[model samples]
Target: MQAQILNLMRELQRALGLTYPFISHDLAVVYYISSRVAVMYLGRICELAETAALVERPRHPYARLLLDTIPDLEMSGRDRAPVAGEVPSPIDPPPVCAFHPRCPHADARCRSERPELRPDGGAEVACHAVEEGRLP
Candidate 1:
């Protein structure tokens, strides 16, 4: 099974461009096969950046939580905060920032509206906290 998967990956690499869109929720696979990564939540892209950069310094809250869950020797020494609540249904996402419901940094404005994917530093984030410069 592993050999077949590897063979397929090699074939794909040869056939596809250097930068191809490999969509999957498996971070390990993504990290192994792609140079850049885009983290999405509730059908919306929460963050996009270089794989290492995004994993090391996640900009969006969801991205941060997702990266925090990745177990690594270096990261194992650090404490991880739990991601609160279940993911909301994509068919009925919140008005503003679909992640606001479970976001620890969410505020009043978050529930009332959805945030846009605005350029921040090197990636785009769709959180009111990030839009308002409230997220650290």
Candidate 2:
């Protein structure tokens, strides 16, 4: 039923040459409906790219983590690492990288400096680790 509705919506959008911004935590749905995607973290657009590009080659750690949370039928027997840690308070956010406390690649620089959204490959990503080639 949901798939049917989504297909109908897409058809209508195409017929009318309309753009609809569909926001959801459901990665599969986002991948199905969107031409482009923007990944946000701590009220910032951490990564943005075409859906295929974003799904296949996410540059930001947070975006990658979100993709990893999608359940895979092939990995049925293996344990999936769940998205770790709570979302930081937007009202009183961290000074440096908001993801520093949870990020595995966080260094002194990440803890002290904030990263800007910069063009990386086909997407825009905000991560000092990515900018420094520490993560691919």
Candidate 3:
């Protein structure tokens, strides 16, 4: 049923030359349906790029973590670390980078100043660490 629906949507998109602001936590499905992708955290876009580029080389820590959640058939024995820490309250979210609490590379600046989306490689990423080349 899901496959049929996705196929129908794809056909309609091709036939009508339509564009969609597709939103989903299911990365695999998003990759299949979207030409571009946006990764958001606390209602803010953390990363944005062409779907294939973003999936192949995510610049933001959150984006990387999200993609890592997908099960890989070839990496059967690899350890998968779940996104840690509870999501902060959306009503009164933390200041600065919303993902700082859970981000492994976060520093004092991340806790104090919000980062704006900036070009990082082929994608736009909103991360202080990425901006400073702290992340490889």
Better of 2 and 3 by lDDT: 3
lDDT of 1 by residue, 15-68 (tens): 884446778878888887777887888788888888888877888889988877
After the best TM-score superposition of candidate 2, give how far the Cα of residue 26 lies from its true spot, in angstroms: 0.9
- How far off is residue 133 in model 3, in Å? 0.4
Clashing pairs in 1: 96-113, 96-114, 97-114
Alpha-carbon deviation at 34 in model 3, angstroms: 0.7
The candidate scoring highest on lDDT is 3
Name the best candidate (by TM-score).
3
For model 3, the superposed segments whose C-alpha errors exceed 4 Å read: 76-82
Cα displacement (angstroms), candidate 1, residue 89, comes to: 2.2
How much does each candidate deviate from the true structure in C-alpha RMSD? 2.3, 2.3, 1.6
Give the Cα-based TM-score of candidate 3 against the true structure: 0.92
Model 1 regions more than 4 Å off = 2-19
Q: Which scores better on lDDT, 1 or 3?
A: 3
Q: How far is candidate 1 from the true structure (C-alpha RMSD, Å)?
A: 2.3
Q: Model 3 lDDT vs. the true structure?
A: 0.88
In model 1, how large is the Cα lDDT of residue 15? 87
Task: Give the whole-model CA lDDT for all candidates, comma-separated.
Answer: 0.79, 0.84, 0.88
lDDT of 3 at 99: 93
